[model samples]
Target: MGSLMHLIPVTDPADPRLAAYTSIREKDLTSGHGGRFIVEGKVTLETLLTRSRFAVESLFLAESRLAPLADLLAKVPADVPVYTAPQDIMDQVAGFPMHRGVLACGLKGDIPLPGEFISEDKPRSGPLLLLSDISNHDNTGACFRNAAAFGAGGLLLDERCCDPLYRKAIRVSSGASLFLPYAHGGTGLDMVNAVLNAGYTVWAMTPRAEAQPMQSLPVPDKLAILLGAEGPGLPDALIAAAEPVRIPMSAGFDSINVATAGAIALAHVFGEKQG
Candidate 1:
């Protein structure tokens, strides 16, 4: 177990030391909180301390939460500070009710490049998930959860996608975004090409009539599944670049949620791998 001596009590909401947590909702609306992102709840905090590659700057906890999170708190590095406050003060500092009573600021360390992330030297046993223009945080989080649950090697997101580290995205992902290896930037084509050059077969998912049914093909040794935004879906050029595969659906319904589609496709490939 960890020592509680590092816990600092914060009675003032406007304390300069707690500045990183101020106006969280408003800050989340904008981008780039100086390479730092906030994570909420005990589960995510535990994931951050144990599984995530990111560094924890500090932890803010409500007084009532301290006893319940003792074991998890013990994992915090000695150098990091743990700030404790009453529920009211915590709510005031965060600009809303912090029902979870736990929050931590984490540093976004050096993110690997797409080429480096998918390098041939890196040994991986599962497929990769390539996302394009997925702006919804909930959808982005769901994708990460699906990727992690189904044993994806990693994920690659296009430039237009929302930050996986976003507060809501991290929560929605149930902290999968913290540990899952991912690189975000460049166009959808850039992501597809990177994996392809790394000697992986790319499966571009589409609902077009000409696309091959997913069940028709065998899972490759190295595969990358491509998913796009809800309404617009994958771009024509991107779909044309890889083996177009579709999940067989009803006559009128041509599509499903991107995250759901990703889960179904990943589950199919995962089951095949196990078999």
Candidate 2:
């Protein structure tokens, strides 16, 4: 059980509880833990707490790092433990500068399958973003933030994409990933098949000349923006299978960031903003 008073004080860096916390900048590139993701700082943690999908087991906060939050510590479930450490150790554990002064460890919960998220009644005709294989956390997170801000319905991620619940993605998402309805860790091919089968146009957002531009694209009433990675873009196999579509842009500029493209697409698709 967690107690603000009993918060275990760790003076040594060898503590096992702190091992999961990694630097935000380098973790996605080199963290050895397989199939594991991290969520750093306070806002991201708070967002995760609100969403019921993931189970947050513990939190590690630097005693000196008191600048990160409000007085909501007491509001967490009494059973969830909160640990405190020195600023230096917290910095080391985070693997980056610890401006926010708090870190948390959580297990990823089961997410909806591709088909389920598309028809997900939670958003009710909301714009959806489908990711092909965007490995970068920044893009994934940014895409989520835009989806939430613009009232997009939900988010769909294929197997190749980075975990949205991961610390880096969560932080970049400003915790929007949690607020947004997303079904993670599905296969691109399966997601494409399901979206197509469900009467969605599966507008593949790319710059291929033959692809229909966003201006002319028939983004359905219930839409899913098929986005790819930063440089690699969508795999040819996936694009070939999906309904070819693109977002219109200046001739020289091939595209915008996946997240930006998503926001633009959402505005166009849900232009009327019904209820």
Candidate 3:
């Protein structure tokens, strides 16, 4: 099942052949349909090829970087094209300093149906984690870290959330973002209802004075924690539908990082031992 090698030496940075991945700049790839995703470096690209559900259209690498990734390339089906571009040309095409020396273009991974990502087939003794409007890849990535670390069943986000497979998020999660399942789409209300219908209590995280303290709450057998963006916090609509819970803070201290709060809340929800 080894991929066929095109071995074309690309010199011109503007080569039309690079069009498939040239516009894969961070901003353009963040959220869209028909937007392609590029996996850079040999390790990550290979990992995505093997682990993700996305279609792999092409993989490009520098001639020098090929030997080390040969085994990985061999895993790809023979029909898939593996292109070789000069290292300098690749650096130019990427518009970034080249370190790993290889990159690829593939169809983006589509978010699965919310139900499939958090279904009963999902191993869950407790509720899930719902991420809404927290588009910062780092925060979204950290939330995923906390979700898996504390044994939350799945990671759920709204349509507007950052791409989980975005470069920064993937780097921050150190590849764990791909290990667990996540879903997107629907308004935050729809996400809450989905979890509630699945018999999980939904607690939306917020720092409002009216919110119940996280430390004092009795967590349900299944729980979903709704986290908002950094400064703005959760929307009022989501707050209205979900139980608003706060991680207690000293009077002077205002709020915690959404990701940090996620970890603490997940720990409490799973009844996991704390540091």
Candidate 4:
């Protein structure tokens, strides 16, 4: 019964109003759609409407999804348009079969600098997760989910990292990317230096023999856990610049997936905080 529940029927996949929703898969891989990112699925849509810091530009849903999402759609702002289409039109617009039957375009507002995001003035609870050259969307999304789960203050991604706002990444994150405050730019070393200058003790995660075990170190008042892409791992200079820590694994196995490693490290920090 929300005022915004008046659904605008979208019959044509080529409609100008749904221009942002057209060829979504291609757009997701290419450039920003006028500072807007697509959020898909019921959960992500709910997060977009209810909890995300980003503004809901509009929503596109299949006719079948209207009833199931009625309560959630009721929360949409009056200015935001709610467009409904047949499943075929939705699929045609998205360039794929519309299994989820829900999608929303969100405006990416101002992205803060790394230093600004982790500023001393900002009230934060747990360590910040810093990512370097993690180009995989799944890993990027998983990292965000893990960061949110463990109460991490926020995330900082180097320029080489994939877009956490990518549609698949946002969906994989279970919408964590929508709410977790993150800064994605600059070199890995740049992010490390920024946090160090911000008075956060940096722990560069590596699999090197010389790196200390993560659990052995006491968590700092402000900590930043740095993780790099899986195969190459953290750059040596970056590792040398910070305190190197490793999750001890069995013989012959040196490392795990970057996101998994990040989860373990964040969990260790979370455990220490609870203790």
Off by over 4 Å in 1: 29-34
Q: Rate the local accuracy (lDDT) of all candidates.
A: 0.91, 0.73, 0.74, 0.88
What's the C-alpha lDDT at position 188 in model 2? 91
Scored by lDDT, model 2 comes in at 0.73
- lDDT head-to-head 3 vs 4, winner: 4
Candidate 1, residues 1-275, lDDT tens digits: the string is 55488999999999999988998887862256458889999889989999998989999999999999998888999989999999999999999999999999999876766666887476887999999999999999999999999999999998899999999999999999999999888888888899888888999989988999999998999999999899888999899889999999998999899999999999999999989
Error of 1 at 6 (Å): 0.8
Q: Provide backbone clash counts, one per model.
A: 0, 8, 4, 0
Best by lDDT: 1
Candidate 4 lDDT over 180-263, as tens digits, reads 989978788888999998888999999998989987888899999999898888888899889999899999989798999999
Angstrom error at residue 82, model 3: 1.8
What is the Cα-based TM-score of model 3? 0.84
Itemize residue pairs with steric clashes in candidate 3: 126-222, 127-222, 127-223, 128-223
Residue 261, model 3: Cα distance from true site in angstroms: 1.6
Candidate 3: worst-modelled 10 consecutive residues by lDDT: 1-10
RMSD, each candidate, Å?
A: 1.4, 3.3, 3.1, 1.5
Worst lDDT run of 10 residues, candidate 2, spans 28-37
Worst 10 residues of 1 by lDDT: 25-34
Per-candidate TM vs. native?
A: 0.97, 0.84, 0.84, 0.96
